[model samples]
Target: MTFRSPFAIPRQLLTGTTSLGGRSAISTRLRCNQRGLATVVPPVTQDATGSKGPTAMVFMNMGGPSTTDEVEDFLSRLFADGDLIPLGRLQSYLGPLIARRRTSKIQKQYADIGGGSPIRKWSEYQCAEMCKLLDKMSPETAPHKPYVAFRYAAPLTETMYEQLFADGFGKGKGGRAVAFTQYPQYSCSTTGSSLNELWKWRNRLEGKRANGGSEPAGTIQWSVIDRWPSHSGLVEAFAQNIEAQLKTYPEEKRDEVVLLFSAHSLPMSVVNRGDPYPAEVAATVHAVMQRLRFKNPYRLCWQSQVGPSAWLGAQTSDTVQEYVKRGQTDLILVPIAFTSDHIETLYELDQEVIHEANNPGVKRAESLNGNPVFIQALADIAHDHLQKGELCSRQMTLRCQGCTSERCLGQKKFFAGQEQASMVI
Candidate 1:
């Protein structure tokens, strides 16, 4: 069966499509021969002596604190990020103040959820397992080395980058790395922010000169798998989990159960900027429903909106409360956006939302942490990306309609220009 990507762009239109000052913005850095095609080094499938081992597979996500003790630091870093929170000139002052004020309460939330978030544990496991599969599925890029780069919390992006250098990846030795976003849907505040951070470090550590000079000859070649909202395997995993939850209800009430597809909410400011998250998230929900053959009624709702800003809604908690009050208590809350269990799932959905409803009829489907099906899906996504040798999805080349940040522009140019650096067998 042919699967269509919701963010799909035709291959022919990808190159020379985006421009700045009437010149191709992306391919400017690419080394093209007389024939006008990107010239790359020989593909690293395998040497005659042995396998082409140790391909770096970096999993990128906005991580949570592993213990209550780490909550303050986590919140501080989170609030400090202009990309995620955007506090203007007072960001340095207000970010720490906001974090300090909220730390105690947030710490308690972490305590309530068995000391802290389980994201770190699950992310490491998922990446490692996926790499094990990649070693077999794509032997050309065999011995895929798993690495996790969280935007906030321990094992942060900088720390992960340092490890890559220590592991003999980029200190004047050419290698390949793929930045695989853990978020299935793309969001500037999420995946885009992570990519920006990654690019920042690559420039800082890899000797990109102050005057915008290029890196050393033998540095790491980078590519990204930015978004995969409607992959068949991912849809199947979500559908199976929802079905398992539905089976707990009696046959008479099963068909009547409502599917509440919930994702972390984005601020209206970001939404107005033309962020692709909302549309991509809806794609995941629609694909899952199709996989289930539209067995029951469903609605996509938003959750985990922070601060006083107007956010995307009907909010998940409010949606659950109103439905229970209306005597439609049979509902299944599916966390569609997050691949692994975190505060949103364990504390917010379970502890706060469902607990407040006080109805057993209201339930949450299991998170996709350590689910073999989901892990296999991750491996499948990675294998396909490695085989294709595209720098990133064509969708990544186009910035948000209202984007003005130079960081976003530079990051896009650097990654998109990597067509020349990419290995094609």
Candidate 2:
């Protein structure tokens, strides 16, 4: 999915000048209608003389939509990835006119929900909560440091790395080293993007040279925490959410509800290229649903597709419509991809699906937001990863002792070159 940008540049970035709040004021002054986001400085750090500075933990992930104007930018970023879509001649066929027209409707969806996308907010909350959990369970030492660096937005990896370096994450946050990125689930798209960025950052730091015609940069001692698909606790959390949400409906409706599991859709051609995103989510969904063991029928489908490209088959809307055509009333739409309730599960499922599933006969369960069980599961999974050599399901470890790493970034051999700009210096 395309991620929206609230501004030309996020204000939290560490501009080279050390004047306190210098760039921030300039950014705000230069703002216009297009730079529509507020500029708020995050918490800062201090030195021996108590000079205030920055802190780090900029976790990175692809952002979701934020504003109407951002819809196209998000789509461009989404479709730009060959692993996400195969535009073919469709772009030329549909052309910019059609692309804009189609994307306008999608942007309105975000505008309706407040102005910006909720992924950034939800991720920040998750990062904070994850840090809190780590502090509680293990003091004096922490699990891998937590940060939220958006692949498409701020805190961008370079920006956050700069912020953390300034703040003391890695010789930046009080001179203590910082460790970023350890997403529980492994996917080339998510973990892959994070790993490549960190490696580039490290190259710039250590001054490692890029192979091919790429750039040279130092590197960060980033632990490549691979995706953990079968984390039983996390899987069980989904199971519990299904059961909890199902309780809202009477037993009769519960028995008939469709166990619809939804993940962000990728292009059909990209899926053909061996992107395991769909398969990874599916495996997790199946394992979780089996644990839940409801008598209802379930199906996996994709959502938030854009551009003229053909995405995975049976879009959520179409699938829901089909179910309604078949006379099903109660429908439980589980967000297997996201662990929290963001715009997708909220607006998409709530307004869009509720509207599309117009069968006066249909009903949907809200996404499993940061519910108690879900948060607990997240904390437990991280804890399990610490105890076991690899990630452990609530009940068992998914990886054997032989399998130490959590990801498979080199599976396809797509390499990234070092990219360090003077703006960061």
Candidate 3:
């Protein structure tokens, strides 16, 4: 059962395609590229003996609860993170209090959207499709097996690591593992936290081995997909999806339609500390707008600001109301920061903000969940890492440089070492 806005207008009206003669934005944009979308990708060659052991691509993200009962637990775990809350000594005491207070309200919101977040389902599907694409792209390497590791919920990062070790992943023998951060934009709080948990598990395993525990299979050489906010395949996916949504609007009003790009908000405190999230999110919007050739006037906004310590702004809901006040009735919301449909897109944007705005034209574009182009983008990233034998992007050989954030810096150095070791072999 899916949850759609009860106040949502008819399909045609919502799409802005009345009986008025108007060309669908999708048809107009995609007419030339009907065969397949063009993307900037590195050449993939069929080279055997790339790596010896099985290749594991583990996708990591901030997970949601699978059921209503898990809501409080999810919130508690999320709030308990010092990276997210940053309450220091007060966090252990206040995290549970905050989660307890917010649980019921958040639970109701989740119920409004079919009783749970569909993030895991969509994430798993994306991973599965990416595996297929990776196999096709790099026939020389062992077929990639996809795994999901959530930071704060079931199938947690530790659980996934244990499973991989049990299955002989990372047990040397030339086994290669890729920790792909699902967050296209890098942030100290999100990707940083997930990777830290992952390495902690690795260190624990080494400790066990040192203490006379039986050594498992071979050691696994690990790489990472740190950030790809503006990868060509990813940009194409967003542009195509936005154009498709725009086709629903009346052709005459399409030129005046406003594209509102909303991303999850981080506290200004985080930004003051030099967290790169806001800048990276803006880069994504800039890239997508460039891809669309700036067809529509757009604004980048923030959503889901929690715990109210002066998060990023102007807030999405307030922006919607302000646009209406300015006689801008035709608006389309693009969740630029989020890759899949979840509470932020489903409830916060769809149900609360749009519903409260009371404007029929203020509709939302769907998230890029399991889009084939996006899957290809992910596969391309992994294939590049495997071929180069380094954790890097097409944009850079080392994406994080001169970085003060300990986790980000450490991970980059670790991958740089891996690249050096590969050269020695």
Q: Write the per-residue lDDT of candidate 2 for residues 246-336, one digit (tens) a residue.
A: 7887776677777888777765655665655676787887798678674678899877765454668677877887777877767878878
Order of quality (TM-score)? 1, 3, 2
> What's the lDDT for residue 357 in model 3?
77
The C-alpha stretches of model 1 lying farther than 4 A from their native spots are: 1-52, 209-214, 418-425
> How many clashes in each structure?
0, 37, 10
Whole-model alpha-carbon lDDT for candidate 1 = 0.80
- Predicted candidate 3 versus true structure: per-residue lDDT over 356-377, tens digit per residue: 8788899998789868888888
Candidate closest to the true structure, highest lDDT: 1
- The reply for model 2, stretches above 4 Å from the true place, is 1-58, 65-76, 79-83, 86-103, 143-145, 171-185, 201-206, 209-219, 307-310, 386-425
TM-scores, one per candidate? 0.86, 0.69, 0.81
Give the higher-lDDT candidate: 2 or 3: 3
Give the candidate order by descending lDDT. Answer: 1, 3, 2
Clashing pairs in 3: 15-248, 15-249, 16-249, 16-250, 170-220, 171-218, 171-219, 172-218, 172-219, 172-220
Cα lDDT for residue 42, candidate 1: 23
> Least accurate stretch of 10 residues (summed lDDT) in model 2?
19-28
Best candidate (score: TM-score): 1
Instruction: Give the root-mean-square deviation of each candidate in angstroms.
Output: 12.1, 10.5, 12.7
Tens digit of per-residue lDDT, candidate 1, span 1-425: 11111111223222221111111111111122324354331223323355455688999999999899888778777766778776566666666566677777778778888998888888887887898889889987776877788888667777777767766677776678899999999999999989988998888778663444465776888889999999999999999999999999999999899999999888899999999999999999999999998989999998876555577998898899999999999999999999999888887888878888899999999999889999999999998898887888888888888899888887887887644323211
lDDT of 3 at 133: 77
